[model samples]
Target: MSFHEGGPRAAQQKDTRSPGTGAGTVALFTLATIMCLLALAATYYFFVRTTTGQFIDESALVRADTIRGRAGRASTEFLDWLPVTSLVIAAVVVLFVTIVRRRWTAAGIAVAACMLANLATQLLKDWLPVRPYRGVQTLELNSLPSGHTTLAASAAAAVFLMVSPRWRPLAGFLGGTFAVASGVSTLINQWHRPADVIAAFLVVAAVMLPAGWLVLRTGKDWNAWDGDGGHWASSRFWVLLPGIAVVVSAAVAAYALRELILGMEVTDSTSSYFWAGAAMIVGTGHFAMVAAVWLFSWAARRRGPARR
Candidate 1:
């Protein structure tokens, strides 16, 4: 039989296509939507019924109130910087993907997806009537979606789309971590209810999955090298270097800020520090996995095989 007919290569090809199938994509999107809805419902019930707003038990309400008070002292400019940084990072990833993989369609999809996701989040926030909660001395409006969570999730999804298949799992894990962190941060700061954050996550995922699939389908395979016995430089290697630098610098800064500047105690227990560390580790793994994909693609180019 020919290579396309009942061979190992054919089987592998079928397996590869399985993930890109219409049904599979639909299933994934469905699952993401369901999870987000459930999360939103759970958070809404918790905030409305429960008397506490803190993640930790025992004086959780007190701690949440304290954090809210301290938020004023925290520079709003610095807090705004986080979303700006995320946007910059997403732009860099898109640029790298386009230049290295020559996947302009994919890059465009990433940008469009994030924009749509952000728009959806804003619309949802506007449509939902804000429920006011009266604190001991103050009152605040509770919205349906959190901007931070939305931005983080959408940006992370864009990054996940720019990398090779081998690195996608790591990219997804990192994206999920950032999404969760942003959501939790909102809760800890008492800036948003859990439902708001969950809604943001859902809106992002609903937009991202379809965008990614469309990009993959329409994008050109620019990694295909001519068989001219001349070495063609792969841009993947260079693209990975900046990602590595960003992850390392961010991790180091986070560690220092938590332990020294913030004077926070780190223990084996599940704390904010633990979650921060987890985010760093996930980010590091994503960078490393992307780097590996770059190296592997380079090697495959040299070997005259299909580049990942």
Candidate 2:
């Protein structure tokens, strides 16, 4: 059965979807939440407190500092707009999905996710101990779990949660693109290292994945669909694209990192590490978005639909 895109009905108070024990969604929520925390912890350990991680991170920053003049100014200017832009976009998305769709509970969950993720970024960035001096010339301040990347990613995640399942594939693709682009912009502007941005994506996912389950549970009626039997543009192509892009970009990143590992001519700012950093930014961010989609889909399927 197809759920018509209409205004809030009395029926929406009770989700049309089955009210199973929700054991599957609960399990998924647990795993996804754990993964988020794991991602943050692993990133902090490897990138913030370790020597090897500092080398790669600082090297990427050093490379980013190479672009001089107009190009550099433009990138920084663009990145400067990201935080505000992300918030605005997220606000608009939430407003439309809530006001137009009248999905009060879903809207609430999505906004809460966005706010929680960004709040986590601030807490981790400031409350966490500073990146210890590892003999690296980089800044000593804490920058892991970048605030800017969190802003972009969480905003995108909010939109992903607000949209319907049929639209999630496309929403996920576009949202991932915006998020990865924001992370890359931070890299190009030398605002954040690769690990910091990656940590941000992970943090957002950690907060949002559980929130997504909440959205599914509360708004079960409107959340289910008969699957996407729509246009190609709205198909799994969008869903698969991010995973494919991450794989390809990861391959590219590994090749570049190998050049550095082999002690090839990777010392200068002109080395392949720049591309490696960018690829890491893209891969990690998209991977998180894909996982978000998968989590929501899993939650929906697990709950199944109730008889009307």
Candidate 3:
């Protein structure tokens, strides 16, 4: 008999189907565009006017000093590493999807989306006349959208696209956290203004959402393909535990290293311990939820047989 004979087969077939251009994609793109426009307006209003420019520059300098004082040298260095790490993580995610799941088209789409976003950001930066604060020069060009923010947003979007739906919430949480942290760090480091970071994020999202929709419509089962059905498989339950452990451990170690080895003080008050505790609880709860779902499914299947 064919695999389609079973009830499970029908459900599986339906589950594997792709979603078309939905309201979510449309809304996301629309919002992104609005944000980009708003960012542009903000940049012009604040930077072009002399009085507004002075206020913004003063504010930026104050904010930069606050962040620098709070985070110190180690945090500054760590923030500097964010762009590199984001790129590496995005590359690794795409490589895993292609190599393990054999989803070449999806992987290609991810790469293309990232490249397009990066290229768009660079082009916008070059074309725009927004300038940075220079003591002698008054204003310097080529500082519209921050490249670090663009890279962070693009990388997060790529990772979100490649992961399974079951893990999407966690992926989103982590991705958003990383993006915000990166943007804030850039602003605090005096590398870019608030408007620049906002513009970069909006542009990246604008490119990625449509790209995600196109990838999804291409008949790829992004979620169903378990990663080789091994211990390292991309199950939501398994991923949460290990992913949290790794993130928490890394954060704690970095904090410790900064304090002891580098003689740097973290004045954030809420250090690695707070984050670690939160991660552990959230991860454990998510795992429990997945276990409950599996149990419910199994129970329903068993009851059906007995009724028959």
State TM-scores per candidate. 0.58, 0.87, 0.60
Q: Which of the two candidates, 1 or 3, achieves a greater TM-score against the reference?
A: 3
lDDT of 3: 0.55
The digit string of per-residue lDDT tens for model 3 on 183-277 reads 66666666765556655666766676566666555623443332223222324444455456545645653453344346556333433333332
| Residue pairs with backbone overlap in model 2 | 15-221, 16-221, 18-306
List, residue by residue over 1-308, the lDDT tens digit for candidate 2: 34543434334444455422367667768877897798789888987788878888888877886664687777678788877888888888889878988889888888888888888889888888988988777889888888888888888889988877666777888888998988888888888899989999888888887787777767766566434454343477776889899899999898878855676664554547778888999998788778777666555543333211
lDDT of 2 at 271: 49
How many clashing residue pairs appear in each of the predictions shown? 1, 3, 0
Error of 1 at 274 (Å): 15
Candidate scoring better on TM-score of 2 and 3: 2
Candidate 3 deviant stretches above 4 angstroms:
1-12, 15-17, 21-58, 131-142, 223-308
* Residue 279, candidate 1: alpha-carbon lDDT: 42
Q: Which number leads on TM-score?
A: 2
- The alpha-carbon lDDT assigned to residue 121 of candidate 1 equals 79
lDDT on C-alpha atoms for all candidate structures? 0.54, 0.77, 0.55
> Model 1 TM-score?
0.58
